[model samples]
Target: MLPTTRSLRLGFYTLAIILGAVLAAGLAMRHAERQALVEDAARANQQLALYANSLHTLIDRYRALPAVLALDPQLRAALNGTVSTEQQDALNRKLEKINGAARSSTLELLDRTGLAVAASNWRLPSSYVGHNYGFRPYFSQTRTQGTGRFYAVGVTSGIPGYFLSSAVTSDSGEFLGAMVVKLEFPELEREWQGSDTLLVSDARGVIFIANQPGWRYRLLQPLSDSDHADLKATRQYDKQPLTPLEYQSLRRFDDNSELARVVGPDGTADYLWESLPLTAEGWTLHLLRQPQVAFEDTRNAALAAAGLWLALVFLLLFLNQRWRLAKMRQRSREELEQLVQERTRDLRTAQDGLVQSAKLAALGQMSAALAHEINQPLTAQRMQLATLRLLLDHGRVDDAYKALKPVDDMLTRMAALTGHLKTFARKSPSGLRERLDLAAVVDQSLQLLDARLRDEQVSTVLHLTRPAWVRGDAIRLEQVLINLLRNALDAMQDKPCKRLQIRLEADEQLWRLTVTDNGGGIAAEHLPNVFDPFFTTKPVGDGLGLGLAVSFAIVHESGGRLSADNHASGAVFTVTLPIDLEAPVSC
Candidate 1:
């Protein structure tokens, strides 16, 4: 069989469930990934901003120290070659005192010849006393450009720091020398020691400051021959090798944020990289933040969400399936009920047809009996009229009066017979029940078939001794009798002895009418089909084969049993009706 609607619906719902689960999973994964990315970017940006602000504030705080120190009369007089050796020594002590309060690594005054005129670290072992610092970019650039800044390893102290310088001058703007201050970031590196990776790179992409010592002075990019030569001449990093850090830019979000894969001692790891420009120092600050924890949390949340979504989808599908099943069941029940009603109507129509067929069969037989029955009474009345006329002609008025009474009696009998025939032929009411006389129904039926029975030489014997009453439609009961009598007549037509016997008997609970024909018994095989419609042993034109079948149906509808059996000499049909004790008995 083809699949039912319910099955198809289930199949469709199953597909939808699978698709919905897949869709939910995909959405959850995407949402988690997007959320992780956004959070990482925001965090990286915030850290970058903080680092940049700290670096800027540190630089700005010390930026004015070099310019202000350049204006010192002692430092200026010593750098102008106007101060004596004792005065230069005094200026050195003074500069050392100032450097201690300024938190600067070194403070020195150099002459226009790039020779140290005075220094703050003159008393130290690694000092700048009498050192020729003209090879330094800061000193040379400051003499030419009036001010300069650079990151380099100090030639005298052998320590790395950012150099800031300002040229010294008289009121006439003559270049005397330069005052320089060295800013070391050891404290800054200590402050940055934590989980986050912080780096400051110079313009050439050389990492100048880093929290991790291993990353300091490393090249963020590859060093070409030109950059190598420049670094060599400047001695910016001293003897430090500028190795390129293993950093690969995987994806860039914008100018400030990017995803980078960095090869480290542990393994390759991804980091969200954010950068900010240090405009005053011509450098950049970078912050590398690991997002593993955030991503792990997001993954767990996404899985949970996907699980919840799948469960909800299943619940909805289950409820929908239940509702659809209920509707289908209701629709099927209604369809079954309608089909049953149609079948009931068909059965009622067939019952009505059977009753109508029995009536028509009775009418056919009555046609012949009606002529014979009317002719007899009519003939007797005509004879009586002729006799009355004769008596009147003989002047016997008393005798004529007696003849008139006999004629009137004949007319009354004729009228009564015609009335009964008319009643038998009329249409029967549907589902009507009333008190009825069984004997009268049998007499009326026999009266209609009387002429036909005589023509067939069939003798009918009635065993109705008294009136038997039943509750039924009178016309239908009469039709049942007529059909039985006609069948008896047809059965005995070819037999030498044609006899039909009818008996009406009753008990306390039941009344029965039996019609027996004295003809050859029906064939054993054909007996069972005797009451079936269109089943006949007579000639085709002689009978329509509906007589017994219709009679059986009529009796059955009137709450009676109709049965047929073979007797020793012929066929017997019996009808048994339930007795109605409340019915009045008639004589």
Candidate 2:
């Protein structure tokens, strides 16, 4: 039963081909992973650049404020002599006005001895007035370097802010004092929307700013005794506990970036840690991201390499066995092209159907708002008619006539509301944008819900800027506004104290509208999915949970953004739309 020479040769060839394919696949997978890492590093570097720019822009904005204030004649004159109580009051008022205008955190005028003579926050409990910052390094650096910058936690205010200082001198060139401006970074942290961990570590390797919670004040490296002494002297991160971030470098891509296994507050996890030196502030911006690879790419790479190897091995066999193999290959290619074309057409049709169906579903889901808008005007007309009857019965013909006019107005409003609702029920063209007043949309939504608000006894606060024009479908925008208003009302329905605030203002070149409610806020876990279709926290029978989803789509369709967040009291939904330049400016 021993195999012949030819059979044995074929068996050996088969084993060698299998081994070669396996090696090729393995090598391809490794290459895929390395390529993925390279891409991730590129993205991380770009993100690092953006973050560094943000930090630099923030510092540069306030860096000149202290310098400009130092040149003030009043500040120079005050620093030259002892500041009396009245002069201190005048300086405080001036600083307050300037701080408000500049939108800086807090400004303080310090004497030559570094005692705060006047501060913008003089009225607050943690005011900086009378607090001497003589021990801080920024004060000394200003005296020596003429200008200085330091980031620290304010000992008096218990708030963390970047301190920018400039020297004040007299006509004789004598060092008079330092003008200091404090800049807090809470807003900046909130604005960093990256999913990766962003940490800003100072020269001492202590992280002072982080986008992620519980990451701040952690040390990138162990602080030396001198560093600890300096921290204590400056009270840089006062009252904040500093902890070591236990980590091990797994791989180094370059000098500034690496892959690491870190035991952080969240948990033990691996991250691609990238660092950028912020030379201006003596801080290092670090971005920690988990390495991510697409399974599809790896699998395709392995398949492609193995297929190429196998095809070469089988090429001569196919040519020797079947001279018609080339014809079959050409036929297969044609079939594949036809199949792809068919699939593309089918997919396009399906997508079109889905979009149309979603639009219909969106309108159908707004039955409650439609009912309210129509019924509100009807109810108002009924009450006005009753008043008219009473006045006519009491021989007050003028009052009866006046009341009838309101009833007529209500009927006209009701007709318009129903007309718009009917029009919105039909599918409109894709490019149905119209230049309309965003403020008017807000007013219309509020009018529709006014009766509901009164019924629920919810106090309202409105801060609207008039003539806020934007390009969008008026009815669709109204629908979005009404959905936000309705959600706010539902949130506060069971609250003991119900308060709803609606604000519409200009932000940059966009019209920003916010709807806020006091209803104990949304649960943290549910916040992310609030606008997801069919995502609802209400009782099963109460809703199908499509309002916010529809509103989100409508806003996006109008080239706008819709977002939701939890505030101290409850949830706030913001709708941001680009301002329409073709429309008249706000009055």
TM-score of each: 0.53, 0.54
Q: Write the per-residue lDDT of candidate 2 for residues 384-465, one digit (tens) a residue.
A: 6544643453357876676665766644653465344323332333347988989988887787787998999999999999
> What clash pairs does model 1 have?
none
Residue-wise C-alpha lDDT for candidate 1, range 238-349, written one tens digit per residue: 8877777898888788887888898753468898888877765778888877653344444454555555555565445455545655565565566667787666555565
What lDDT does candidate 1 reach at residue 527?
78
List lDDT for all candidates, in order: 0.74, 0.80
Q: Model 1 segments beyond 4 Å from truth? A: 1-23, 303-308, 311-337, 341-587
- Output the worst ten-in-a-row residue range by lDDT, candidate 2: 421-430
Candidate closest to the true structure, highest TM-score: 2
* lDDT value, candidate 2, whole model: 0.80
